[model samples]
Target: MYDIYSNAREDSWRFTLGKCGKRKLLTIGLNPSTATKEKSDPTVARVQKVALNNGFDGFVMLNLYPVRATDYRTLPSKVDEEAFSENIQKIEDLIRSEKDPVIWAAWGESITYHSFFRRALTEIISRLTLLDVSWVRFGEMTASGHPRHPSRLAYSWSFSPLDMEGYAHSLRP
Candidate 1:
């Protein structure tokens, strides 16, 4: 099944943001970097910092394939469909338990493109029509001044609180 860890020492996945009761946003990622790897993913840290600064109090960061050892680049091959299914169920459980509306924010294109999320969301949409859930893209910028994807802006002008607070403000409703 999907292996989830809470502490930063046990896993690279860390929730650096301050928890203010139930979170209004839930962030999802493909998986955490190998713990033994010297360099951690800068994008993950950036996401955590930005989300916290923007006042997104609650986040559920998930790894579609939760295994201790696996190549991140070749993720499609390593994914266990059964385990992935179970992980989504776990996420749904969290969403159901939340008291406020929670947005489903995808960390990168990898998560947006993953079939597990896209397909599962279609089903979730039908069942939870009144949940007020939506998807927001994160970490599209890079440290080198180059954009993560050429078509998208260096940062999400639409979602970045640093770049623009309009999107965050609009979420209040």
Candidate 2:
């Protein structure tokens, strides 16, 4: 069965890996990188490890934006409206698939790469607030208070509760 979901094939504009059971730890990254169903990238590998270590058997990976860029610096200077809207719908579906979903805020400082990052996150937060989801982060937040991205984290690190509302406000301009 294909647990990985995407709106397109070549330039996948929206991607979500929702394997495991209903009890999943959903992670929100700044955007999707190069990971696919056939292979795993460092971020995806790290997320899977963290989830297993933290009591989750499988994980759900989502992102503020879905454009697959090898680096955040390469994401289009602006987001396409269709991609943004579709990604939100995918996010909502993931949320509804679980009970009291526990989400990990792992987008890190890249949230500042563009104004759209915050806007996309704001939309995510709005949708999450409609349900009973738990927001979490790994280790201490950065100096500017963004969540810790898996790439920079120690494998031994664990999760901590993140104040979703306050965290969102801190990112606003």
Candidate 3:
């Protein structure tokens, strides 16, 4: 798989930890948390568990922006457009390699915080659509049409890829 997070300051980027190949689950989230060796981020753990249970042998992750920040407000106001654009291309390539992929649109409300971030996210999904990839949700969407945050998903919930026209409409750039 293309290592989108392999850059020098890659510790800031979050990525998949398990098996990766065909029939993959590519999770889309906000910025990554401050996970360390002593503790794993609960959200990433939950997504990994769900992907494994759903027969997805491979997993990947793509975020709206490439930077890492535990809190959204701490993110840089100006994105590194070159790095961000490269990561987006890597995401597109990863999805193309999967025979039947499930992209988890789990960005939650962070999409509402910045117009630039939201526009980049919408463009990523638009590109994915051209590739005919489907999006899956673990639980209910918020009023703004985002899937429940990974931390909010219940262990018993099932995955489903419902019509996202409502979400698409809400993300107009």
Clashing residue pairs in candidate 1 (N, C-alpha, C atoms within 3 angstroms): 23-58
- What global local distance difference test value does model 3 have? 0.69
Q: Per-residue CA lDDT of candidate 2, range 70-152, in tens?
A: 79898779778888888888898878878878999999888898888899889888876778889999988988788988898
Using lDDT, give the best candidate's number.
2
Q: Candidate 2 clashing pairs?
A: none
| lDDT, candidates in the order shown | 0.44, 0.83, 0.69
Q: Where is the poorest 10-residue window by lDDT in model 3?
A: 1-10
Error of 3 at 123 (Å): 1.5
Q: After superposing candidate 3, which stretches have Cα over 4 Å from the reference?
A: 1-5, 13-18, 35-39
TM-score, candidate 3, is 0.83
Q: TM-score: which candidate is best?
A: 2
Q: Candidate 2 — worst ten consecutive residues by lDDT sum?
A: 1-10
The TM-score of candidate 2 is 0.94
Among residues 3 or more apart in sequence or in different chains, the pairs in candidate 3 whose N, CA or C atoms overlap within 3 Å are none
